[model samples]
Target: MLADELQHKIDFKTKPLGALGHLEYLAHQIGMVQNTVSPELSNPHMVVFAADHGIAASGVSAYPQEVTYQMVMNFLGGGAAINVFCRQHNIAIKIVDAGVNFDFPAGLELMDKKVRKSSRNILEEPAMTSEEYRQALENGKSVVSEIAKTGCNIMGFGEMGIGNTSASSLMMSRLFDLPIVSCIGRGTGLNDTQLLHKIRILSEAIEKYPHIETADEIAETFGGLEIVQMMGAMKEAYDQNMLIMVDGFIASIAVAAVWKKDPQILNNCIFCHVSDENAHQTLLELLGQKALLNLNLRLGEGTGCALAYPLIQSAVNFLNEMSSFEDAHVSNKE
Candidate 1:
């Protein structure tokens, strides 16, 4: 089997057994993902999905909702952290206006996959209708398909939307059967009073819909436009057998939603890092995954993905470039 072959090849490298630790596993996983012993990362891209949440108006986030579009502009101008890291690592980056409230000028460089001005306030009603949810999923698939046509085989998911953490928290609570308070976090640095208010508001929102049992229902109830789109993109990437690098809390929730539907997709995903968000580590544990880094990152612009890209490259690099014990004429253990 290919798994056996990959493991044997990895184990024969000129080093103590398991000396390379997680990098060896990463190489094996990447080899499995690409169906090759000598796997190469090509045309790596980071897709940032930006949107607006109507629940942002309920004091869930520290930043105002306009920061969504503002950060998108910062991304376009090469001023965001994601841009800097992608530039440093030579990875291509694209921004998608999934459902931000503000409209950009014509001829903007980003992909215009907007489904609406913004999602409906989940505090009052579902964040999106079934039709809107489907559209967002289609938009996500479309964006990833375009990237794949360019021979990109590895990509990361990032998100930008005020109150998106709220959506993610709510989804986590529902999907994991955890309390809303446990899932809630101080998004964008909420103070004590603000955090308490956020917890109360999200708890009430959960009360409005107490029986969201399925992934689709949870998503439609609380998923942001970019979150749903990211879920779609993740599913599409798994279909194409591409390596998926998932970012922080919001991105992890997107993966969680996708995983709930199709459990097999987890094999293609490499969680980049655990964020400082309260439940991020818990979410990772529940998913039975570990992140590549933990830099106390709470910023959600695909920064973790970009920061961790080189390590992924290192994994592939050593697998392809390192000599075997026989090749290096190194003595093997008796």
Candidate 2:
């Protein structure tokens, strides 16, 4: 339950009654997350998880599997969109090799949490063995734990893996009990024929898992290395009471996996945006949540988090610095 006292503090702000609309709600939610009337934002970090999906070999994406590692190099060189947005906002960004196929030379600034070179193609078999899934979960937890130790209480998650949107679409269909067609989308610029092929492929892949009832099984059956690890990081962040900035569709699916296991995790999450991905709006509707923005954004490297960060700061700023009616000696509304 939210504290009644916090609600009172928000209502008593100097602005006209409810003038701030969702912003007031944003302030209250952040206040509740921190359990303080004067909540502060500190040490914001955006973590981008990179990996390769074996399903990528099934001709599901516009790009090659090598782009997974190539984009990781782009991230390290500070040339990707994520790097640009993070640098603009001064949010620290880190790349984790959750299960990318390539291995960088020693001394590269990256976290080596690879569980394997890539996942097993789900259409053919399980994406990963249970032990591998467990390791991915633990790796995610450790990464977030270390970040939290550095006084970072606000965090955002992103992912980069060719064909991962297929992985996400499959998980959404199964975990949320929706039709695979409703969950399908044009990931990475698929043409009409390619999109139809993707739907048929994923639909057949879903038939392979007839008995996945638990969260772990669902994850191992229909998740990428980056996504599974993201699920773990999300749970750990929620457990530690860290605010979660959820990116687009793939990131939302990761959060959904965690939420299915423990619904309370949604309390700390701020849905950053409704992605341009077709299934994203449906996913948000299923969660009964409103995203902060919708700029037709389909880029998925936590760009929504970066774009939304300033608004989050604004929420805190108004709560902490705005003039109260009494403080400004303004007449009360009649």
Candidate 3:
């Protein structure tokens, strides 16, 4: 698993040595994980978990609560960007309705693990009960375990929830010891006044919850439904050595939560992008991850992870396909 021979093979590729930069590094990492000099990357999966946040009542987001179900309907109707991009990359997409506060039609592929009708109002108390938080975490982990048993070696986790950004903002502020102002952003396009109000609301939520260090405590205090579940999924995925392609913003926040619980998971995870959200850069800085893209996208539908798929695929492709100079009978670099 040292990947030394693999590195040598990569170095001898017919292109200028190391010309591929991080792509080469990425390929090497994949090969080491597979314990193969030439690794085959396959069964890419994009799992988008949708839920609702009661904290939206506090005016944290620019979007209304109705957008949550409306977007899920769009996703199932194949009208969302994730649907389009997943088709382009040949990646199977799974949409999990982890804890949506709505009536999902029967017999759809919707997952119905409703932790509660909705998260608790954070203005007055913890966002979720401790048991609900643990259950959501287990639900998330079990979901990933099911996917892994089916031979998915690489997983992209994205989320959907109205007002989740507020939950994430509070979580980040606490986990990273950053000011509430630094953790909060203009989620879904709030004006300065609205952003300030959002910050105050999250600050109040954090202040209301008492000091706690465990993952469940952290989640119960400030986490939204899908966010905590996604954190559990990430931990399970890393334990399985499945590559974690993190989506932007809220998705990254969940990833950050996993990191707070266990930093070693970072080795198997890849940060996908820097979201348009101002808080994302600071969160990424706290995680010490430089994302692959900076497209300034603030959408939370796994669009960033879907777009980064090709680059990841190309890295493994070059590792397995590109010929060595000796094999190609080509001149070596001077």
Candidate 4:
């Protein structure tokens, strides 16, 4: 049930019990999950799920909802920054139409998992119906399963939607019992008046909808197709004992959803980075995630995850390569 081989490798090659600090610990965790000291990080995949939110029309985000559609086009054309970075890092990127409102043209490997054309107006009502929420959950699980079948155990998730930060802020405020002031931020460059309006819109959303008592209730009301899908994917990864890397703020919200269902899911996650978003810290703290990086990055297209892969690889690499005082014939410290 434990990683004896990893312990053997660590004890045989490394310094003292943990001279390598967190790297030693990280290697141990990876080795245990992978069941080998000679563990390999196979096929790292990043799934950038695109969706449209009705809240965008209300001026929640500085950018228009059309950006989501246009961004997806950029992703398909390999013109996005994430695409370029992923290519440089050798991380395969897959773009999915989780619930982009636009009828994306054919040819991309688009998954048919759209819940609705788009989410309901958050100003008027909860985002999605309970049935739609369940469907989103299933679709998320299905995506992870597809990746697992492809021998990809380690996966990362990201999202693209204009008003999603507003939704995430609302979710953070409600889910963590934090004040809107602590969670809301100037998403996509909101001006002073627009920032104030964002705070007000989110505050009103909370007052109108109130707290969500269950996971399904939360996802049903506040979840996007992309967000809930990441939740389901993470749940599936946890169930299967695979490693799941979380991207930026919106991707991190999926982990919060997973915790909303089962708090123990944090064991399977390696939070890749901290974000500039104000609520991101609170959400990560609530999940008890001491994320691997504090890059102040708010770019939410698996960029953090891509940036984190080499760090993880380094941890694992050093674990298996670094020699002990005995092996190197060096003096040991007391």
> Which ranking of candidates, highest TM-score first?
1, 2, 3, 4
Q: Tens digits of per-residue lDDT for model 4 on 1-334?
A: 3677677677666366666676666788788777777666878888888888888888888887889989989988999878987898888888877788898777776676788877888889889987888888898898888888878778888888888888787777677777878988877878899999988887877788765666667666776778887788789988877888888888888788778778777776888998888778877777877788888888798889888888888877877678766888877656
Q: How accurate is candidate 2 locally (lDDT)?
A: 0.92
lDDT of each: 0.95, 0.92, 0.85, 0.81
Sorted on lDDT, best first, the list reads: 1, 2, 3, 4
How many collisions per candidate? 0, 0, 0, 0
lDDT (Cα, tens digit) per residue for candidate 3, span 187-273: 789998998898788877777766776666777888898998899899999899888999988988887777876888888877888
True-structure Cα RMSD, model 3? 1.5
Clashing pairs in 2: none
- TM-scores of the candidates in the order shown: 0.99, 0.98, 0.96, 0.93
Q: What's model 1's overall lDDT?
A: 0.95
TM-score of 1: 0.99
Candidate 2, poorest ten consecutive residues by summed lDDT: 1-10
* Predicted structure with the largest TM-score when compared to the true one: 1
Winning model by lDDT:
1
* After superposition, candidate 1 runs with Cα above 4 Å error: none
Screening candidate 4 with a backbone cut-off below 3 angstroms (N, C-alpha, C), the clashing residue pairs are: none
- Pitting candidate 1 against candidate 2, the one with the higher TM-score is 1
Q: Write the per-residue lDDT of candidate 1 for residues 1-334, one digit (tens) a residue.
A: 8999999999999999999999999999999888889999999999999999999999898999999999999999999999999999999999999999997998878999999999999989999999999999999999999999999999999999999999999999999999899998898999999999999999999999987799999998899999999999999999999999999999999999999999999999999999999999999999999999999999999999999999999999999999999999999777
